[model samples]
Target: MSEPRPAYYAAHEGLVAEARPKPELWRLLVGLGLVAVVVTVLNLVLFSVVVGFGSNAVAEGFLTGSTPLAMIILLSSFGFVTLGVRMAVRRLQNRSMGSVLGSFRRSARQFWVVFRALLILGLVIAVLPPYDMGAPLTPNLGLSTWLMLLPLSLLAVLIQTSAEEVLFRGYIQQSLAARFQSPIIWMGLPSLLFALGHYAPAAAGDNAGLIALWSCMFGLLAADLTARSGTLGPAIALHFFNNLIALLLISLPDNLSGLALFILPYDMSDTDMVRGWLYVDFAVMIVGWLTARLALRR
Candidate 1:
């Protein structure tokens, strides 16, 4: 006798079926290696081109610094990861690009549905009391400049978040679930990898472990939404909106604050303050996940 499939995973069979043909762990590992190589080579090429053509200051800041142009370039480069995923799926898995994405129409529709729910939640949170952060937020971008850059900034964030969802939820989760019956193996593994990617000790410093733990829980929640919805839409929407708030709206002054409208007085290394904020973020994330689930139920 087999274990019964949970109701939340009702739509996951379609994704698993798509992965059935090339479900080998070796294939997944090799595919990831290929993606890394592709990303490296492309970034190197881009770097060389920028350095050869641009000024020394711009060249130096392009990858390491957080100017608006630098941030846009950095975020948009994640498209290479999406391209690499496509290539790997085509070559190694012998599958179409659509194979990893479940259903295009369903994904698109769900993206809007979840995005709308989150947008409302965001507005409600914004209007609630005690909005101040114990200090006034420093203005980062001029209103006119930010407005001018909004379209491109949004596109960059969409690319970054969607690329991540395509790789983690669409490719890794689907492939793992196909090979393993247990959600612990399939969901937990990809979520762990996703968490590892966010473990930034150099930046987060003393708070790095907690930040990574937060990322792991976030990944688990995202993985859950993907499994339940059977599309990358909800996860992508969640990630996109979260990042939109962090990167485009208000941000930490020390990092990635270029395109933001306002900047926090404290940095990520301000562990005590940031840790408390992280708890708030955790609560918001949970509510957002539940909201997404409820939206799907409608």
Candidate 2:
């Protein structure tokens, strides 16, 4: 006798049968636009009220308004909203959220390996000639202040990174994968969106074009890793290490003892750093993709 179909599969089938047709892309886009507007307004109001008492209204307001703390709050709020919506939708279909999330969780060991890989790669870049350190390496905090804020900074990074991963690699990628069988749509769409999200930061000040190109390349690599791994582990690890390097270790000129950190032998004044870093980024992407494939092979 044939084995019985899994209850989860049966439930999925039943839901598909009764499920309403997918909404138009325009509708989805409008809903997301509204959510963005609401979040922006809420964030501004909170920041204005909270920091309004400070001496420098503009500086304090902006620091409070756009800092990682604000990002964490906004992202966590959205994460919870997404989680609730998914849970409700699953319940309506008699499905378990745990099962759904479980399907995407990766091995802890693999995750750690990816993190170590990124950390080492970043360190290597720091030590190599023509490093340029990319940006100014100035620590805003004194030793005492750093001690007090390090934990908070780390917590903020974790929250911010987790929020992005959940939104892009988890929710958006999975939804796209389910809706469209094409890997290009599942991976490319999120990658493009992620890149566009960095446009403002990347386009600000000097070397804007180079920064934007690198930012988009990073997004593409992260998206490819997510797609290949079928998990957010690699991308999260890479992003965490990327932020840590850019924020802490390499962010101090004095910290560059063993290697020259801020002076590049070759000029980086090129409009786009794409040609220079493209191969390197592509190599890292391949490593990430291959490592993920190898881990999943077992």
Candidate 3:
């Protein structure tokens, strides 16, 4: 049989009909959900174990002991778990693992462009005066530490963030699109869920609201990018870069950092400062969306 025309396949009417041709959406979603649950549980357990060990070491005044190693191990394990699940799912579906990996391979060039653009954008935002966000750069890390760990840190950020993109933008979004045939369901639902997953227990007052709003907006932009590109490349790149810069470079207030391992030197206590920085983030999302759209057009 001949392959369906691209235009026909892209249409909502035809896409929805095609989505029903296979009876695997629910099964795929359930499997992915199970993996997510297992990862979450394991992370909690690992974190607790690490904290316990760290507490004992700290009481003994051990300089070499720190939670960073424990944190890295937890994150690495989560990445492996997700990868294992993806491999298992592909085998069960009789799909080629090579094809799954191939999607990520084909988008390599675009990924670099996306990363560079966001990195520059992040640098600009970090240096702006109103926020004085760039002040945190001075005490970021020693040259030796940066040279030694930056590469590993970048890899960790990429793996962690890309895993999210693959699960939500690639797997979940595609699965929903294949089943419902409606852009709203495939695109909107995943984004909303993603936003909710970012909810912080420490958020209070207006800060809580702001965090929720930002999460939702980011999710929407990512979902839209996935829909336009017909792949998770742009979203994955955006997410990875957003996190890399935020973790390694950006200097926002302590509360705004939201579970960061290190705190920035600058005090971001003022509400205006937070709002201004948020506006910059929103602008970046607009630029990211435009970039993804143009790339997809090519």
Candidate 4:
């Protein structure tokens, strides 16, 4: 098939629609509920295990609990959410998970090309001077532990980012596009939900609203990548690198810092510093997004 125009709704061109040729509007609502339930139950179970089998005392200290083993389990929870989306696809749309993934042959090649390019950029930045970075947050892991868990952390980030893209840009976007011809309905709706889902009041402190806006922008960019590439490859790669950097390379001094190489100098609760941090993030996100778009053109 000729490549469709890089419009928002065009991402659905390669998807399968055997069961729900016209997926009812209600189906998407129900699908979201199902995914929420699956993610919640899995998270609770995983948290319980990490807390040594439902210990409230353990739960209270979980945030400061920076064990390599605990980090691995928590990060691995991302994979189960992906499984939840796959199950939802089978039940609601009656389509294989591959349909949401786009054509494997194409997605696989694009995924790697984007990943390697982003990875190279990330390495270069890592070696650059700290410039305006304030005080460094306390290091959580020793050298030996960080080296040991780095592989696992990267895998978890990939699974986590891929899962988010599949749900927002893959299943949800394509499903709506199949029913609605307007790019507004197909693209805006999913991106809106994507931003809402990322709202973090306590974690982001006063900057929560800005983060949500950033997420919405990110959702739009990912949707654009999905349309332009005719697959989830570039979207996944973009998200994967974004998270890998935030969650693993340098993390806020908060709950999920177990696998990080460096920690922020300021507290997440510090309003002024976080605002500054967000400004830096905006620059990275914009550049990273453009890189992916340029890769698609190549």
Q: For model 4, how does the per-residue alpha-carbon lDDT over 1-298 read when each residue is reduced to its tens digit?
A: 3233344434457762442475787877787788889999988877767677646755654545354455666666767777887888788888888888889999999998888888877777778878547864567677787788788778877777888898889889888877765667677889999999889887787888998988998998888788777789989999988887777767776667767877887767888988887888888888888887776667
Clashing pairs in 4: 135-265, 137-264
Q: What lDDT score goes with residue 62 in model 3? A: 24
Q: How are the candidates ranked when ordered by lDDT, highest leading? A: 1, 4, 3, 2
lDDT, candidate 4, residue 77? 70
Candidate 4 error regions (>4 Å): 1-11, 16-20, 52-57, 60-65, 124-132
Please provide, for model 2 over 24-119, each residue's C-alpha lDDT reduced to its tens digit, 9 standing for 90 to 100: 344334434544665566657755665664446444424433333433343344444345435433543333433223234453454677776655
Give each model a TM-score: 0.96, 0.62, 0.74, 0.88
lDDT of each: 0.88, 0.49, 0.58, 0.78
Better of 1 and 4 by TM-score: 1
Model 1 poorest ten-residue lDDT run = 1-10
- Best of the candidates, TM-score: 1
Tens-digit lDDT track for model 3 on 1-298? 4233345235223212323445376667666766767677766776666567767654222222123343245335548555645754564344443333335554676576666666666677558766645444345345566556666666766777777776666556655666665566777787777777776545433455666677777777877665554455677788887776565454343422322335455543555656666777777778766766665556
Weakest 10 consecutive residues, lDDT, candidate 2? 252-261
Which regions in candidate 1 have their CA more than 4 angstroms from the true location?
Answer: 1-4
Let me know the TM-score candidate 4 reaches against the reference structure: 0.88
Worst 10 residues of 4 by lDDT: 1-10
RMSD of 4: 3.4
